[model samples]
Target: MATSAPLLGKAAHSKASIFYGADEYLEELKKRYAHDHEIAALKNALPGEGDPNAAGVAQSNDKMLSVQKNNENRSLKTNRLFPTPNKPDPMPQNLAFLFTKITPEQMIYMWNVLTAIFCSQVLMVIGYCAALATFPDYWWTCTLCFGVPFSYIAIQNIYIDHDVMHGATFPVYEWQRFLTHPFADFFSLPWEEFVLEHNRHHASTVDLLIQGEFGWDPEEFHYALQQWAGPWSSNWYKYLLTVPFIPVIHFFGLNDTGSLFALEWWMHFPDEGAGGKCNKEFWSKWIPRRIKHNAFVLSLWACIWLLGTYPLGRPLSEGWRFMFTVSFFARIGYSAAWMFITNFTHSF
Candidate 1:
């Protein structure tokens, strides 16, 4: 009772010692006690054995406050980037239309054609070379040797490849199955891997933005063109003059400055992996099982070198010389024309 005045001045209306005239103070005190009770209950219900003591209560409260603050910050950041779902999202109409046109059936047809063309191109290359070997005195033998491979590529494209890519060349028609398989060299590709990578490329195609070099990767030509474009970009005539060598270097690998060294090394040991990692599962591992594998091929190359002395064993020298002049030059011309025709169809 003696200290009621001091306590009443601060709290105004404690239950044990109330201020009789202060109705507003009584209401305020009730609200404060209600809030305190709720906080105490929340702290008790929390998962951890929260401190019953003042210091522990303060630490627990601080942690809860910090968590609430972090959540509020994250909510603000997310809202800024992606608006709440009530608003209508916009997309390009043309792209939407394009997607609508694509169907599962179309995809299957496109796959069938690409598979056929790739196989046929391989056999066609070999067949074209074999044909060139038959005609010894054909003047265009020089031109034909080169021209045949590219022509075969074009024929395959027009007759078989295009229709397959368009998905119009399905085996639903008898001719489609007949033209695309044994004729095209059906077993050349690992269809699963090629299909996945090519489909990714197909999805990304835009005129010049991401379209690949015909079916071949354009990256192969990047550095080769860099020197011509740089320093020579301003001189129009000089660039034009260098265009002839461009195809020569690109297809035949002649101008492949550092890669020529790599090719020489590779020729010593044939590449059994079809441009993939060398592993036990790869064809390179089983190469030794063949009698005419790396060892026999290398021996043949050694024989060619040994036979090249002008005065010693003229028969071997003459035979090897004729063989290489025709076969070697023929292969070079074949590769060049094939690459050029491919580039022509796909380029803008």
Candidate 2:
């Protein structure tokens, strides 16, 4: 199973080229890939241990694990060359035209505007939902109020961040870390891990077998897909309960082991469950970063509490329960929106 490194050309990058010699090869590959998922047996699949344990990490490019432990060359970057538009086709006069990059100033200005809109939309949802919670009669109304606008704006932000991750907005990848601070964090999607897993989807959208760090083998990559598929394929309660409680998991004695793969570039692991003492010394000293993330999120919630108690006018007696309720509403909208998209948006 030792495969050579990919060549330096489109043929090497083309996933179809891997099976180009034979007809019906992709169809057969699909069946094999599907069979691997079937055999992996989601019923018994462990959620967080998508990669091997630290002691048994995989470094070779041949074995595809969801969280590929390419610890061998963690410092080196592995990026595909994207074609620069020589003279792009004129975009029809629409809001999408803003996404096109003509100059650095234009790119930053547009992304900043988008960042403002995304933050404001989220804040509005939170403020409205928290305000309406004071009215017991409008409990269900709060659901729709948050769901509609939050889902609409979040999906748009997905496209915006998608471009950001592709290095369209920031020339430096690490600087993209700030993109998560309040917006992506509020949504519970870690910017680093999402960008890594997401770009792989585009790199090999047809077969999803990208070489290098992601470890594209389906046999090992199934759990990552299962995780991304979210509640549609993974345990529903795990997503609903465990996901939001990540910042609190370390407070209790419980923690799920996370992906052992460590890289300077890729920095977040919301789903990988990186917290607590059991894995205190694991992941090449990188897992502890999750603690900082949790702390930062908690700090933001503290900000939310001040916002809720004073500006939103919640009683001091309400404590964090009111803030948690509003946060729950926000997450439920995100969960519902994502599940709906994954389950119904495409025909597989």
Candidate 3:
């Protein structure tokens, strides 16, 4: 459906006047002659309704007519004009107020800050893992179980995933975006796809007919479940506490299909071509693209796992393991924080 444009200030004024019978009406005629020069002054003040001050003049005249008496007739005219203030047009919604307008230099500064944090996470993991390796016999029990995976989870999952998604974690070169954007398939959903879907969500927001399809509305899901499950259904607390489960649900490809509409677009990037190839190419292209991403992700993970398991000269297997584990956890933490921030602001 097409969106209705907002009304302008002049259009609103003219529309209001027509509804209240302000122009060329019986009451207006009496007001015209009630004080002979009154209408002339109004016409001078308001050249046409298109004039900027026309609404103001019309509104002020409406107010004055109420008190100015004409004793020759009834206490007031049969129809009375309702006065309203002249309000300006509303401004458009701003999606990128916080960061988009920032200078490229400032953006570069943010990029550097993010890079430092990412590098620091890697360093910390290596340091921790090396210390564990040195005391392997003594701390083997404690380090083997917890230390390794935690570090991997933090670095890969939190910092690296965040940087790529925001386009901040890597160098600004084309090769960097090309390399990192693919990583989305592994740790999180596809960033390019997510951004495209996000744009539509912003465009449509509370449009109830279209808003909830892409897992945007948990309330809708709970409501549906409650209807089927009946009064014995769990309360919202029991229902909503499962929010953190959404990402995992998405990861397992449960909500993987998301909105069919967005997927339709994905299959048809730029979405333009000849008829047969256009339709056939969507799935033909989509499957391989997904597979390629999966292959890349699996290969990357395999390398990480291999490095973690085998001794690489002086660097012990445990050290690599810790680095991988911290990276993963850090990503999860960052994803949770980012999601909460988005939902809190936009859901308002």
Candidate 4:
């Protein structure tokens, strides 16, 4: 039920560290922690802010009730913003004052999260193996119960890759891609391609809001699923395509437009010939990158299968099922969820 604008910079930090052991996270302790009592008390016995909640002036339940209703009551929901814009500042604040703050706990968090991500990857394979070996004919029950949620690691990787791409994770931005790649490449697009694609989306922010005079968007695909638009395929045909490998389709370059395939060959490669012709030289430069990415993705799948078979002591087939769960099944679930959200949103 958060309502106020997020606190930025050091205003967001908790000055206190863990009192006993190392703090597991950031955030100031709450003041009047969990005071609601009536099936709940009719009155507050809890202290106000800046004190231990032993005893304080008791008030009616109005404050708690009002606060929990904050979003519904706020005037910010109107068609016109209720509050006027801020007056221009004669003395502009220093940008450094709002630069993100980091603490010792926050510094080690990347290693902690990366460990969790990779370790969970191993656990995911183990879970699949356990399901296959233990239950035999009923193995799919375990995958349905556990593998579905676990496969969301693909989504998690994209989120981490997003932060890394934005250079917000660490000051060593160039090296951050090392954390993103091959891992985030699970989605099949190289980190560079994702960066370029996402940057263009951001660059098109105004265009997304304002359409051309013709009443259509300037660009057909604002939300990255451009392939689904228009007379591309029948609905059931798209589902059939999705069933085998569409989740990882971007990896195979089937998701790429002809123009996208002919785009720049990245920074270090030889330039495409003048006017962006799709001649042999251009294809030669782009094909190498395509090969590298395809290898990475295939190798990742093989590692999962091998690890599942040898170490986890399950049939090698279980690894393949795990891949399908995370890719095809996971993609379907997420796409369905995302469709519900964007279907009603102008922000898309």
Candidate 5:
């Protein structure tokens, strides 16, 4: 019992030591926390302690105001051309005032279009030379050399055309107008017709029966099918068969017979009603313009071919044949791919 009493006394002493150490640690922590609080309070009281303006806070305030005024003046000068709206501007830092020069963001957006256009031009020139030199013997290689780049340019031009029509590009409408005609010539779609169709699509987005613009209503589909291939053969099988010829038809601008003939009707008798035909006024104006534009484009291509082949001692006939083959394949491939994507997506 005496030995057990000694061990119990040792255990009591150990517990007392632990409690005393903990109380001392807690007191140290409290002092450290109080010291940190005082330092923070001093910092908050003297925010500009290390600054030269600490003794002259009013001067500092005046300097800030002057700087703000200078910024305002600069902003006013920058925005002299493009006046902001009355509403509170959402993007104050945006470079909206730079009208003459393109910003980094605009350059990035247009990089692909510019690259595609340049590459297509170079490829066309190269293809013309190659076709003139080795067309008859290496027609397949010539077709690929010409057709792939041509197809790429056509598709890219279509994207640019659509973006221009939607006003999605740089806000300079004049620049867009300048590029519109050339792009139209290359894509084989008149700018006027494209605008009319695209605007109609935007206006009548909900109407699904309006032909070659937005949604293709089943009823209008049947009607167009019936009109093209007589009423008795307007079935699914006929539609499937017609699908294969769509790209060719589109390439030749013969997809809508009713629309084409309607132009002739208007030119001859402007006073007469369309009478179940496509819009006569639209087609009448468009047809003559398209004819002239298409002629210009054809002449341009012919000139390029002649320049390439005649000087190189190659036959003109071979040049014509090679160009025609390249044009056909490129147009068909582009139109078919575009149509498939549009049909699959089916959204405006």
Candidate 6:
């Protein structure tokens, strides 16, 4: 009986320990549940209606939510801040694609050709000036000497400008940007306008009737003919006279003058109302800049002519005459050649 009493006492102690541990665990779980309940109540409370302690808890939770939202927003902003780099366009497989292939040998050949052409122009100009200076009486010979070479150079540059427009050159040679682009602009169509017009032509493969330099639209042509040949003139005579002059007019930049009026109309009368007139601000700013650019280019040429002639005892009047006469004849030659080649069998 004594031994049995000791065993029972030990079992009782073990059972009490187990019960104590279970009570501790239950107390911990109850605390956790109470904490969660308080949080829920705080969230559910109306603004300014909860207990002071509950309000404080709600405010803290509100701040936490706000911070979390801001973190998410910041994450979103960071993701969008910098864009991925774009891949370059792939080369097209077409006739125009041939221009894209530029081997080192080809580049060297082009460089050599450009150098020879530029040198020839310089030599021709020098010879022309020398002839004018030495034999002022033989003006016709001087004219031919200057006009032929100058025209050749002009037309060659025009072709180069065309290539540049088509991205066949210049764009490949980053180092030649200044010479091929801005400097060239002074002698040909403005680079910006040229690219715009050329791109329009390329994009109009199916829609060829769109108005442009080479397009078949006759609105501007008819207007020009009426102004030049008189409104009542025979259509056949007008066509004969005006058709030949189209290329010359284009080369001389006269074709663009009509756009000034159109621009003025568009700026002020965009909505098509009769009360709208030309915008003074446009005239004051845009027109003057264009005029200045053209005048500056012309003045540079005039200076060259004057300086070249002055050295040879040629009068300024004779120099001016020489300059204009050569320019006129060269333009005529260019126009005739271009028209003959491009419109040989085509009706338009």
Q: Model 1, 31: alpha-carbon shift in Å?
A: 63
* lDDT (tens digit, per residue) of candidate 4 on 101-181: 434243334434544565666566666666666776876687676656654664565555454434322212222333343
**Residue 147 lDDT, candidate 1, scale 0-100:** 50
Candidate 6 structure quality by residue, lDDT tens digits, 1-348: 222332122222233463222234334333432443323232222222222222323332321111111333222222222112232346455645443433323333343344445456556656777787788899787877678767767556545544443322222222222232221222433333333333322321112222222221223342354245543345567667666666654455332222332243233221222355544434654355346545554664575567555766767766765456555644554444434323332233
Model 1, span 1-348: residue lDDT tens: 212332223334445653322444334433432433323333332333321321222322221111121333321222222112232236477656533433334434444554556455445444443444455356365445555564455444443433343332122222233233222111111211122222222322212322331222223343234234446547666656655665555334331111332243233222233355353332532232222232333443444334333333345446455335433443344334434443443343
Q: Give the Å error, residue 235, model 6.
A: 8.3
lDDT of each: 0.35, 0.38, 0.36, 0.38, 0.40, 0.40
Writing each residue's lDDT as its tens digit, candidate 2 over 1-348 gives 002213111122234443222123223333432432311222112122221112122221211123333345221225333212343346556655555424333333334545565467657756664656576477667656765676556556555564554433232223234444233233232343444344333322322233233334212222333344345554765556433443332112111111122221233222233343333223643344444555555666666666556544567665475456545544433444433333223323
> Candidate 3 vs candidate 4: which has greater TM-score?
4
Per-residue alpha-carbon lDDT of model 5 for 200-248, expressed as tens digits? 2332222232332222121233235323554434555666666565454
Q: List the residue pairs that clash in candidate 5.
A: none
Regarding TM-score, does 1 or 3 come out ahead? Answer: 3
Clashing pairs in 2: none
**Local error of candidate 5 at 160, Å?**
2.6
- Off-target runs (Cα >4 Å) in candidate 4 are 1-115, 169-187, 211-219, 222-291, 307-319, 332-348
Q: Show model 1 residue runs off by greater than 4 Å.
A: 1-97, 122-146, 149-234, 237-245, 253-348
Instruction: Give model 5's TM-score versus the native structure.
Output: 0.46
TM-score of each: 0.31, 0.43, 0.43, 0.46, 0.46, 0.46
- In model 6, which regions exceed 4 Å deviation? 1-119, 169-188, 204-238, 244-248, 255-296, 337-348
lDDT of 3 by residue, 90-169 (tens): 53346334323223233334434444454454454455455555666655554444445543443344444344333322
